[model samples]
Target: MREIRQPGAYSYVYGKYEEPIATVKPGETVAIYTKDAFTDQISKETDRPSQIMSNPNPQTGPIYIEGAEPGDTLVARIIEIEPTRDYAVSALIPNFGGLSNTNITRTLNEPIPEKVWIYKLEDGVLTNNKRLSFPWRPFLGTIGTAPALEAISSITPYDHGGNMDVPDVKPGNTIYLPVRVPGAYFFTGDVHGGQGQGELCGVALEISAKVTIQFDLIKNKSINWPRIESDTEYMVVGSARPMEDAARIAYAELIVWLEELGWDKWEAYQALTQIGELYVGNMVDPNYSLVAKIDKKYALID
Candidate 1:
């Protein structure tokens, strides 16, 4: 096992195939310490987002995986996500979120209040006000590999899996991503103590955490988008705009995955119509993400 600490190495974008901070062989586990999405910009005293000028969502690393290459599959098994801080923060930025007028919504009304809420993580629960409390379910909000050709902002969620704030990306799940560059420059950050389905406010319980993940490689096995295999379900993720397009993309990838698993295309489609579940990962990101999932019991893969 290797450990990579967050001190000077960080990235604001997903591509460019930056140099690796560490290299590990397939099946090796690495523990990474990551910062929150705001890069710890907000504190109990902080009230506005403008106080921070640096690019947000600073990712940990583009750790090179030995034997991983373009056209292959990189399997990352999330072993654990433990918060390094006692508190996490969530805020409503002026021009961000689903309800607020964002850069895409283009509303003339004044932006929403830039309010910040700090939640205390204690005894596996996150509580702010006496009325607001929930179990602390830690997960990485951004985890992925480098794209084939372009440098994408860490805020965007695409095929290469940047900032896909899906709750299912927690421990006990293994995410399979397609390799687009040599060594599969894998990096991750944006740890969240918890988040709802839509991430409605464009923010979740952002916190710095230590993530333990094991990496593996599948030679000649490739995928178009990210796929997740959990204890009970197999899921395919698709990220795009117009919400419906994200759903379509997810279903399409699910169908392809089913076919690759030896099921007939039509049979797979039919099964999905009955058993598949569609989950909206994030509608507030640059690309809305959706997950198409089916229980392993119904997978019909021998």
Candidate 2:
């Protein structure tokens, strides 16, 4: 196993794949250390978000997988996500989040007051005000390969899987990403201690983390979008605006995936109507992400 620390191994935007800091063969495990989304600018004393750096969400790497190439699928199996800090932070930004008046959803009223809350992580739980305590469900908030043509901001989630803040991307889950460039140029960061579906508040329990992941290559297997398989379910991810469109993209991919597995298109549609589940990954980002999922037990394949 190789290790890539935060120093000198970070990207603020996803673009033409950069040179790999480290190259690894398929099935090799790499431990990556990532900084918080705020780039470690916010601390217990930090009150205003404007004090942070302009370009946030620092990702770890563009790791070059030995056999990965365009038109293939890169399988990233998350082994572990351990927080490197004792405390995590969540904030109510001035004009961000699902409920607030954001740039897209303009309003005459003033922006919401900015408030930051720091939570302590202990015994697999995050607690802030004692009245509110919840189990930690740590996950990487950003993970993606470089886009085929254009450069994308680290905050945007798209087919290339930039900042898709999906909670399902946890340990034991395998995320399949399409390779658009040679070596796949994979990168990941923005560790979240825990977050609800939709990431309603615009932020979750943000923390730096040490993440262990194993990579696998599926030669000649191409996928249109990112797909994830946990121990119990198979999911397709989609990113777009107007949330419903994201849902549509996700379901479209799921339906196609089912059909490819030997079920008739209509048959897959009907089956999905009965067993499909939709989860909102993040609504706060530039492009909202939705996940269409179904249990593996319901698979039509023998």
Candidate 3:
């Protein structure tokens, strides 16, 4: 398995122009060492977001896949995510979060004070030390390939996929991304020890992790957005400005996937209206992300 380190190989943007840090062949598994969402700068409870004025989501690579080409689909199977640190940290940043006064949602109220919380891993669970313990549910918060045309920040999510922050991007799941450039430059990082549905605070239990993923190519398969497949469900992700727009995009893409599977367009829409479920990935990023999914058992029915 190939290894990509975080220190010198990380990137802050996703674009076809970014140089590839490493190269891997289709079907080869690679292990990436990723820093926390805080860019590995916050370790103790006393350390605040102010330390890093701009906490960029540093991505781990633009790994060039040997035969990936435009119009193909890149398949990434997450095999494992193991935290490399004993402690994780989260912060209440001044101008971030779903409820706080953000740049887009200006309000007269004062901004929330920057406060940090540190959680330590005891056994397989992370605890705040005072109370509240949950099992380690590590996942890659940002994972995607380069866009065909322009450069997008690591903080934004789009068809090329960036910091979607979805909790379902964990082990045992496969993410299918569109390939718009040669070699399909892939990058991933922002490992969260665990995150809730909306990631309300805009910060999760961030921790350094070693993530192992196997890469493959689906020749000539073109997809408008990213698709995720778990053992029991098929999910499609969409990111946009307004939350409702994000939902529409996700559902529409899911319907498109169903149409490809032989379901009539109208029938697929109706079926999804009744049985589809939505997963909120991120609400505070440059673009909010939402996922529309349906159980495989129900979707496969005639």
Query: Local error of candidate 3 at 229, Å?
Result: 0.2
In candidate 1, list every pair of residues with a backbone clash: none
Model 3, 1-302: lDDT tens per residue? Answer: 77878547467899888778788899899898888877888877788777764647888888899999999999999999988889988889988999899989999889999999888887888998656687889888999999999989998999899999999999999999999999999999999989898889899888989999999999999999999999999999999989999999999999999988889999999999999999899999989999999999988887
Please, what are the lDDT tens digits per residue for candidate 1 over residues 40-59? 87878366775673678999
Regarding lDDT, does 2 or 3 come out ahead? 3
> Which ranges in model 1 have alpha carbons more than 4 Å from their true place?
7-9
lDDT, residue 122, model 1: 93
Q: How much is the lDDT of residue 9 in candidate 1?
A: 55
lDDT on C-alpha atoms for all candidate structures: 0.90, 0.89, 0.90
Total clashing pairs in model 2: 0
The alpha-carbon lDDT assigned to residue 218 of candidate 2 equals 93
On residues 51-151, what C-alpha lDDT tens digit does candidate 2 reach at each position?
Answer: 66577799887788888889999999999999998889889888888899988899988988888888889999999887867789999899999889887
Superior by lDDT: candidate 1 or candidate 2: 1
Question: What is model 2's C-alpha RMSD?
Answer: 1.3
Give the lDDT of residue 197 in candidate 1. 94
RMSD vs true structure, all candidates: 1.2, 1.3, 1.2
